[model samples]
Target chain A: MVAINIDRFVKRYGALEVVHDISFDIEEGEFLVLVGPSGCGKSTILRMVAGLEEISGGELRMQGVRVNELSPKERQVAMVFQDYALYPHMSVEQNIGFSLELARVPKAEREAQVKRVADILQIGHLLERRPRELSGGQRQRVAIGRAMVRKPQLFLFDEPLSNLDAKLRAEMRGQIKRLHQTLKTTSMYVTHDQLEAMTLADRIICLFDGHIAQMGTPHDLFDRPANVFVAEFIGSPTMNIVPITASKAEGRTVLTLAGGGEVSLPDGTALPSLTNDGNVLAGIRPEHLSDTPTPGATARIEGVIDMLEPLGSDILVTMQVGGATLTARCTDKGQFQAGQNLTLHFDPARLHLFDSKTQMRLG
Target chain B: MRRLNPAAILMLVPTHLLLLVVIALPSIYVFWLSLNESTYGSDLTFVGLDNYVTVLTSSYFWRAALNTLIVVNAVVYIELLIAIGMAALFLGGVRYPKIMFAIVLMPYAISEVVGVLVWKIMLNSGSGVLARTIESLGFGMFNWSVSPPLALSVVTLISIWHHLPFTFLLIYAGMLAIPKSLYEAARIDGATPWQEFWRITLPLTIPAILISLIFRFVFAFRLFSEVWLLTAGGPARLTEVLAVYLYQSGFKYGEFGTASATGWLMVIGSLGVASIYLWAMHRRMLKGND
Candidate 1:
């Protein structure tokens, strides 16, 4: 049975539909993330699931019970807000135990449960301190602790780590994933940061223009995005997209990059039927473009280096290849300089092709 | 931090000198006069705290002090409740709350003496609307100004009418400043409506509450315009609060020394209340919370 099932969930703010009819099911103990850019209605969907927002047109069921009309309290869910929403007047102890107190649980049991959750989050020492007295990460932990102490049927996290600093955000991202693993509670998270979705989600729903562009595991999304949007949106230093002319000649597909380069497909490589002379958008991830030629490289292109950014783990190089700029992530131990001409190899198997008019994946 | 520029310090000297001349000088003179014996036209004689001792022991002074204390507490507490209720209603998405808030603030916009005069006429025993309405309701001739409790209640009502808007606006703005996400979090935590208000709204608005409390408290403690303009110390000094007494001592009875002493006492009383509230605010801040 599904833990949370949203059937044709629609959110319309007075004729302007923010989220078009979108449907997805979350399984029990699943860490589902709705990932999108800002204003993509991802947070709206999470709010609808949490019952904080009314489902404008849909049937919502939680663990087989229809909850469309249920108040947030009756929905039996807990949410961690992006702002940490730690009651400034509440001590960590009170904040953690707040849900239990609202339930009118006995004080001794409330204290015990608060302590138990505090121990799990490693916030035992900060229990007496107010949220103002705690650091950002500590406040985040207290926020998560507050949600988890309820042991609710579902957890909704609405960009809960977005307000933290970079280092704290990454650390808390891992901690949240671990918490989900330990509890195995059905969870729905909303975030605009694809990295967080990649790191933490069991399944990710990538939203675009109010609709689900694609939904899959991080591996599936990174490896096989449904369209150009998904392909570009999923990866960091995202997939390089450029229009290319395609044609069938002598039973092999030939391509000419709009940026002024050519590559011929290997024989017997299956591809969608191509017009004699037609244009389609081509997508290649920076990771797939190599600074050095590979043994089985399908094509090689020459270009001058436009710029270089050396991130500690990898070097990201932008090359003025063909007639366009293409970013390539390279870890070539050899030193490279900007404005130098170089040839970068590409493996055709990792290439993504999308129909220009339809913007849908073709090959 | 950058050191203060000498030019900036030099620029501040004029304003500080003005404040010393306009405020500091007169206040020192008042304290000096309180330590001496003087009448409206008599030469000052050094008496060394005799006026303070006399005012402290006088029954009328105690009565007026009690009246001031009662009025301040009654006005602040009542206004606080009304402000919170109105602010909550406005924030609860009552339609046209802005217009309603503006309407409720009408009394505050009116001049204090004018407001008092309007209420005085409205409560007039012979020709007032309130008196006529009460009389029509079989209360006989509604002589409200003579009864101590009723007279004080009238003053309290008018004061609340004048001051409710300020406290309401402060609390309302504070309520607005609270992130909507906190309410969402509370709802998902299974809190009832009452719990949400008590836990989230009240505690989070403590700063506004403290600020409005101090402002309303001290302001009400120094009440004079309404009391003097409406009732003029009333039938047998029943509503003669500290400010009215100060006015009566200097202007009516021509007791300048006693009046200055009363003025100093009023300042001390206001500071006492303010310090308690400020101390509580500081203690809460130190005890931890944003």
Candidate 2:
């Protein structure tokens, strides 16, 4: 096992700087996921760590040794590409044993390692077949098996499950998590899917536009996001952001919502000091909005139902409140028709305030 | 659903009829004439299979067949090697690839007569650029056209050079179509550059190579321009390929029956080679899908 420490990493493609200076520490035997949207340079960061890409400026140390100039093979790392780039001419057995063959391991030992990895992946029967003969899931397993035979200290996965269908992706996700658990090798995974990041990562590194947005455990990211981007990106159905204008009405601060409404703030909840009584963006996740029809300061908005998507265990309901669109997840399956008025409630503590100009979350 | 239009078939009918009149008629007439004994435009007598039998039994017929095979084999193999090597070098980040590729393809774009004439001038015995260069390098000037084997080799080399660009372009396109991720994966698997080329690059290019082979083999077998222009089957008819023999016997010697029989044999041989190649390609494609 080896711990990886990356300090002040930067990458440039000619003139455009893709990965801005970023630093993070990866614990030994941990599955760290880097999550971001397209063009955010998340994959670039992972590729630099894998040594598939050059580090423009950084210190990448593996077990206390600087490995910036090391080639991919010399770095002792294995990568599972997104396309599952198995050698089409080679059979599954040969693909798994390729690295061992290159190392000139004895044929028997190569066979033994291939067999063991194949058994763990439950693909022993597929060894005799070529990549073209296998299904997507089967090919993904062969790709993983190919990596496993190398027995490298670090494993890098570049959206390996992205090509699979939904059910197969879920199954493979579990298998990968199990594999990481059983093998206990330090691994880095990159994905745009928040669910995969939340499920597979021991610590998730959220990135936005080549910068580290936040890095923490799944609970830390979900419960206490450092900024607006993390708050909106980490959850499904997205967080609803409402623009409000703050004003002092008779000494008690009241925030004016669009379409004519004001929510008077309690004495303890002062206006964020960063912005001077100007416009602000308030955020609330869909799950945090409750369906119970009680009245409270946080439950000030009344809305007309726009759409409803029932997900068996939960029903996702979208509603129009004033100028803002709010989504709420209700466990009850009561028929909520379009144009029906409904009262939505939420706790004020779960609400997030951000400066509208800079988009930075305000405490 | 829309019905098929009668006008669409009407538009195709004239071309179909033209094909029958222009192409099908001559093909049938050739088959008919091959079975008859005819000297120029004089007395055409039906001789059944005698013409074929006479051509098949002739000693020169066997020699022409051997020469044809030799020329085709030499040209195809040399062209395949040159094309593959040129493509690899050009695609491997050589300076000014487009300019180099255009220069290599210049021979193929030129008329075959013009191409062969240029090579003839360059390979001429004493005063040619190649011979003079060899002489300057301490090698004596040698007559390439007078020596039968050397003449055949010279024709083969010219054909190789002329046809190389076609194969190179095809294989290069195939190489480009392959995803770069495969090479990345191979590198991560610890494969050396040579091993990557052999294991990944070469095997993936089988489809393109097969296509180039079929095309070059068929054309090389019936090659006439370079051999005719450079050597003219000279110094004892050592380089008299099947196509040249057909032209010589029919046009020069006025032996239409024997020439037609040889032409028929050549067609059958080329078709046989084509079918065998197609069958192999099908099998390989199916095996890949397996």
Candidate 3:
């Protein structure tokens, strides 16, 4: 079932339109993440869904009912804000039970509901404490507990873990994922952090400049990004993109790297029809590059090592290959030194090709 | 405890000297004066609490104290309600915020004495425009000068009008300091506008409200100008407040020792009123730190 179907959604601030005509559907029980850089209108789209922002043009439907004009409460959606947004003067119990109190639930019933949520979030012991008295992680849990007590149709999280320290962020991220697994409520999360998106989202909507860059599952986004932006954005250390010239030779596509290397497209590889000597972009993930040759490896590039950073499990080797600098993640077993000549190999099938002019991926 | 170094003591000397000259010496002098009976060019004979005993036993002193209590309470509470209302309206997104803010604060820009005088003239019984307007509407003369309750009510009104802007500014700043995201969270949590105010805005602004209350309580307890300039404790001295009574005792009757005792009592009373708010604020701060 489509929980939320946003058709041609548009948001405008007077004359300036921030969210263009974008469209998508969130399936029931699916966790959809809107990931992008700052000011990319990811939060705007989430706010529009939460009814905090007015939709300038287009239709928004929740559970097959039009909700463009509905108030946030009428929409029956709960939001966990980036800053937790707990009432500092109220105790944790009161904060969690505020919605119930507003709804005029009986005191015993409200207390039971609040207690249930507190138990679920493991914050029952801290119920008597105020938000100012709670630690950052505890406050975040209280916020989530507050949202949980509502039991709304949809859950909207606006960068909920962005304020937390790294370890707490990861811990809360796992807790949120576990909670989603147990509840299985449809959720939409907005974040600028790609790792959060990759880990938490069942389906990620990559946004760029108010447009949908791509919408797909995490594996699809990682294995086959739809554009140069998604290719560079979805992974750690980012994908290395170098300019290349493409030409057809012997019924196969031949790529001449701008630096000083060559790569031949494998047989039957889907290729964009290009003009003679047309410029193209070749994308390779740092993790995909190996210091030693591996199976299916067809491209070999040589360079002088420029820098090395160790990450306990692996080392990031930045090498100057002609005019282009490429970073490759190698295992820590290798005793690599800067200024040493090194050769790296990659599989041709793992390469991402884009039309340099449009920056859109080509099959 | 660590001893202060010579340089630190040297740096502190100027501040200590200033406090001694400005605060300590005057307080000590007032204490000394309260213990003596004196008139202009008269020998200072120590009375040993006789002035305090007389003031406490006098019906006039008790009447003035009761009047001061009623007037200060009315002014502080009424001003706070109006200030909260104004702050809420401004926070609800006013169109001409700057202009409206300036207008609300115009009373504060005027000198308190001038503001009280303006109110006094505007409400004068026989010829004032507002008084005539009220009388013409068949309210029968609107004579605040003759009736004690009416006179006290007018003083309270004038005090609220003059000092409301300060209270409003503090509460408005407190309201603004509440993060916008909290309101959004409340909205999503099924809070109506009224619920949002009760649960979020009012609760979060308690610190500001308490601070305003403490200041207004202290200032209103020293209420003098509005009463003195308008009624001058007239109509058989029925509208006399502590400050007016003290002024009459010192300047009008030439009883400086009694006036000094009254001054000390006023300080104690103001401090007593302010301590309630101070206690509440301290409790709130301790809870926040918990």
Candidate 4:
């Protein structure tokens, strides 16, 4: 295992910069997932690390040695591409053993290594099958087996599961995670799916618009999103944002709702520090908004039921509040018709405050 | 009435008629002529298997058949090697790929007769450019065009030159169809350039090679223009392919029956070669499938 370090990497195509001044380090044996939306340069960074793409500006080091000028073969890293990139002409056994054969390994040893990797990936029975004859999941396994047989210093997966169906994707994801644990090799994975990033990463590096929004453990991101984009991006169903006006009242700050209501803040509460106006915004998770009413410095909003999405074990309740639509998950299967009036109760501590102008989490 | 279905049989009538007129008519006429003892007129003596038997027994037919095979094999093999070599070189960071490809492909775009004419002027034994240059270099003017074996070899060379670019372009197109990621994967597997070409490029482009082989074989078997313009079946029929032999039998000797028989022989010979090529391809495909 080798520690991979990327120092201020920049990638430009002609005159347009796709990746701008991004830097991160991957510790040996760490599964670091670079998560971002499409065209945010996650794949570009992975390709640069694999030496498939030339780094326009930056230093890349493996185990403390600069390898900016090395070829992909010289870098000692294997990449499993998004499309699996399996050699269509070769059988699964040949595809897996290709790298070893190229390194001039003896035929018998190459076959053994291929069998070993195939067994590791649980694809040994498919060794005789060509890539086109195999299903998408089988092809992906062969692709991964091809990389595993090389036993390189690091492994790079560029959205390897994106092509698979939902059920097979879940199965393969678990398989990949287990393989990483057993191999104990450093790996870099790129994906736009936050769920995959959250599940597979030891630490998630969140990218937005060609810059790293935040880098932390999954819990760190779920608990303390450094900014608003990280908060909205890392969670499913998205964080709900609502505007509120703040004013100092009776020696305590009170937030006024637009629907002719107000909630008083607790004294000395560590909310987002506001400047200029009495205007601000609130971020709340859908799951945190409860149907049951609670007491004390909590805020409650009343609205009309607009829609309901029943997911097993939980029902997503959409409500019209403060001239905007907000979604909240309801655990109690209390029958409620559309257009019925309802109230949502939530803890103020669960409330995330952000500056109205900058859209950054303030406190 | 119900609306008409898009897959109705009526839609095929026009296309079937066109195929019959364009393709079936010529093939049927050729087959009819192959079985007859007839002049250019429609009057035919019903002779069953006579022309086929006579041509099959003739030494002239056998020699022309052997010569046609020789030319096709030589041209296709040499062209395949040269085309693949040039394609590999161009794809492997040869500077100015487009310019080099254009220069190499220039021969294919030129008129065959003009190319043969130019080469004849260059290789003329008496006062040709090559002869004059060799004399200037203190070597006596070499007897090139008048030599039977040399003329055949030179004609074959000219045929290879004319068609090499088409082969290169076909193989190059196939090479481009292979995604770049496969090469990257091979690189990560520690494959050198030559190993990548052998293990990845060559096997993947087998279909392209087969296509090029079929085209070159079919074209080379009837090799008429270059042989006609350059050697005219030359110096004791050394360069006489089946097409030239058929032409002389039909026009010079006024033996239309022999020429028609020779024409049918060339067609059957090409059919045999094509059948072998297709069978080999089919076997290769079946082995891969298994």
Candidate 5:
């Protein structure tokens, strides 16, 4: 069921359109993350949804009522910003109770609501203090508390975890996810961090250049990315992409790589008709390149090792393959040296292909 | 471990010297002169506190004091309202805001003497454009030059116009420095525009407002140019303010002792009023933060 539906929403600043006509429905009780690099219009779209920015075209609806013309107060949505814009003069209690105060809620009820949110955010002791006295993490919690106290129809978080230190970011990520689960509220979270999107989102929308590159479940996006951009953007080390041409060898598919090396596709594969001279990009995730291939292994590459990073459980090995630097996550603890030859294997099903010209995924 | 802290103390010596040569000496001379009956360049006869006592008991002094208080409150309150309104207007991303802001600051740029002169002609009963406009609009022939209340109101308006730019700029910068996200949050919190100003803009800009208030109050108490130029204590000494009273005592009557005593009283009165305002406001701000 749709909780909030954005129908072909467009945002323009003068003659320049920052967010193209983008459409999506946030499901009831679902946490959706909008993930992209800078200038991808993720934040712009979030702001438009929050009613902070005007929508140039199309309609925004909450619970089936068109809200494109409504002010933020009428839309019944809450937002937590990246910078934690807490009022400097107001105490923690006042910041949280501000919305209630604006709504003219009774004094007793407002106090109870403020205390409930403060306790939930574990900021009950700091109620009397102003924002200047709180640390970054505490300020962010107060920002979230301001949003939480309202229990509005929708929640929008725009990179709310980005301002904290790494350890604090991780901790707050867990807290946010737990809070969402407990409240079961529909949420739209925007961030440039793919890791946050992968960890917290029930669904992830990968945006690129003001367009929706792909949107799906995190597992689906990670395993079956729609294009080279998504394939490269969703993974930690990013997917390794190399130009390749396909031909037939021994009644099977053989992809000739950039450096004149060859990698064979899966055995006896039913294939699509292709032009022998057509160029395509072959994508392989770093973790997919294992020495002892997991399952569905059908391709191999012999390359000279460049560098290795021992990341505790898994060693991240760098090697030059087909004139492109490729990173592999390997568990092998054997002594390895640069300039040594190493053979890496990968799953054929995970070998993503995109048309070199259009950069869209291909069979 | 620091010797005489001469570096910091020496840094203050220049300001102290300027104050002494320009302020302290004249002030001490005035107090000494006020202790005796004297005119400029005449030998003074020591009369104890007679000059102060005489000035304090005078009905003219009380009337001038009352006029000063009226102007101070009127200008401070009226200019504050207009400044806040103008500041909010500038923040609305108005087209050509820089040009409009420059125009708004013209009052500050114009010399006080010239400013009051210009207003005097415009407000003149016979040929002033404002007077003609008001009379044409059915208000009848306006003659502020002969009425104390009308004269004082004209003086108040001119004062508000001349001093508005300072407070307007201060409040405008204060509004701009407030993070945009705070307003965004407020809007999401179901605040109407009025509530946003009352809850956020007004509260956050209180410090700037207070500073503007103190500045305008201190200067308004010294109202002289507009009152003197436009009305000159006309219609039976109705618009005579403190500075105008002091000027008349020193120059018109050549009573330097009484004038100096009146000057000292004016200083003390202004300081007392301004500090009370600052203390009350700052206390409220600190308590709100706590």
Candidate 6:
């Protein structure tokens, strides 16, 4: 079932339109994430769905009902804000039960509902404490508890974990994922952090300049990015994009690197034929490059290592190859050093190709 | 007890000296004067608590005290309601906010005596613009100079007009300090506009409200100019407030001892009213810390 159908939605502030005509649908139990850089109108779209922002044009439907004119409460949506907008004056119990109180639920029933949510969030012992008295992680749980108590049709989270320390953010991220698994409520989360998007979202929508850059499942986004932006944005350590010239040589596609190294495309692949010899972008994931060749490895590129960042299990080795700087995640822990000439091999089939001018993926 | 830092004590010397010269010395002199009987150059005769007894037992003093209590309460509470309303209006997004703010604060900018004199002229029974307008509208003349209630009402109105900007500024700042996200959260929680005000705005702005109430109560207790300039406790002193009674005892009848006693009474009365809010604010702060 379609939980939300955002059709040709437009948002304008007077004469300046921020969100252009955009359309998408959220499935009944899907966890969809809107990921983008700051000011990309990701939060605006989320706010429009929550009815905090007005939709200038186009229709918004929830559960097959048009909700463009409906109030946030009427739309049956609950939002966990970025700052955990808990009432500082109210105790945790009151904050969670505030919606019930406003709905005029009986006292005993409201208390029971609040208690149930508190226990689910594991914050029952902290119910009597005010928001100011709770720590950041505890406050976040209370905020989620507040939204969960509503049991609305949709859950909207606006960068809900951005304020926490790294350790707590991961912990809460896992908790949120677990909660979603148990509840299976349709959720839309907005964040500038791609890792959060990649981990928490069942499907991710990458937005750029108020337009949908790409929309696909996490695996599709990670393994087969639709464009150069999605290719660079969806992964940690970011995909290394090096400009190269592609031309046919000996009935095979030969990519000529800037530093005069040549790597040929793998045979028996369904890659589209190159009709012209022009500038193209070759994308390689940091993790895909290895100091030791793999079974499918058919291309080797040499570079002088310039920097090394140790990450306990693996090291990020940044090196200068011709005119481009590429960071490769090298797992041979102590084998690489700065200023040392090294050769990294990658599978030709793992290469992502994009038109240099359009920045669009080629096959 | 922690030992006081000599440097910190040294840094406070100037302020302490100023307070001693301006407030402590004068208060002590007043207390001393209240226990004595003196007239211009006459020798002082110690009459321990006699002046307090005289002022406390007098019917005129009691009437004046009652009048002061009524006027102060009416002025503070009515002005608070209007200030809160104006603060809400400003918060709801007013066009040309800076200009509107200036206009709201204009009353405070005008000198208190000048403001009172302007109200005095405007509220005159026969020739005043407002009086004629009201009479033409079939509300009859104000008769502020004759009727005791009318005189007191005029005083209250002028006092509120002159002092409203202070309370409004405080409450408005407090309301602005409340995070916008809280209201958005409340809205999503299905809160009506009234509920948002009650649950979010009112609770968040309570400290500011309490601070303003404390200031207004203390300031309004010393209400003299509005009543003195407008009616001068006229119609057989029926509109007399505590300050007027104190002024009459000292300047008009040359009873310095009784006047000093009345000054002490005014201090106690102001403190009595202000302490309630002070206590509430303290309790709130403690809870916040908790």
Against the true two-chain complex, what DockQ does each candidate achieve? 0.81, 0.66, 0.67, 0.61, 0.58, 0.69
Error of 1 at B271 (Å): 1.7
Candidate 2 interface RMSD, angstroms, 1 decimal? 1.8
**lDDT of each model, Cα atoms only?**
0.88, 0.86, 0.90, 0.84, 0.88, 0.91
After superposition, candidate 6 runs with Cα above 4 Å error: A248-254, A259-276, B1-8
lDDT of 1 by residue, A1-363 (tens): 578889999998898999899999999899999999899999999888888888899889987889899898888898899898888778899988988898999999999999999999999998888888889999999999999988889999999989899999999998998888889999999999999999998899999988999999999999988998899899999999988897778877777888677766666666665433478888899999887778863666678999999987789999886787789999957577999997778888888888888888885
- The digit string of per-residue lDDT tens for model 3 on B68-159 reads 99999999999999999999999999988889889999999999899888787888887888898999999998988889999999998899
- Which residue ranges in model 2 land beyond 4 Å of their true spot? A247-253, A264-274, A293-299, B1-24
Mark the 10 consecutive residues where model 6 chain A has the least summed lDDT. A267-276
Ranking by DockQ: 1, 6, 3, 2, 4, 5
- Candidate 6 CAPRI-style tier: medium
Per-residue lDDT of candidate 6, residues B117-184 (tens digit) = 88878877898889988999999776878889988988998999999999999999999999999999
- lDDT by residue (tens digit), candidate 2, B1-290: 98769999899999999999998898888888899887776988899988899889977778778888988988888888887887777666788877877898888799888888877887776788887787788877667877878888888888887888888889888888778898999899999888888888888888888888899888887899888898777777777888888888889988888888888899899989888888989998777731
Best by DockQ: 1
In candidate 2 chain A, where is summed lDDT lowest over 10 consecutive residues?
A: A293-302
Number of the candidate with higher DockQ, 2 or 5 = 2
iRMSD for every model: 1.2, 1.8, 2.1, 2.2, 2.0, 1.8
Model 2 has a DockQ score of: 0.66
Model 4 alpha-carbon miss at residue A111, Å: 2.8
What's model 4's TM-score?
0.92
The true-structure Cα RMSD of candidate 6 reads 2.0
- The CAPRI classification for model 5 reads as medium
The true-versus-predicted C-alpha distance at residue B49 of model 4, in Å, is 3.7
DockQ (C-alpha) of model 4? 0.61
Better of 5 and 6 by DockQ: 6
**After superposition, candidate 3 runs with Cα above 4 Å error:** A248-254, A259-271, B1-9
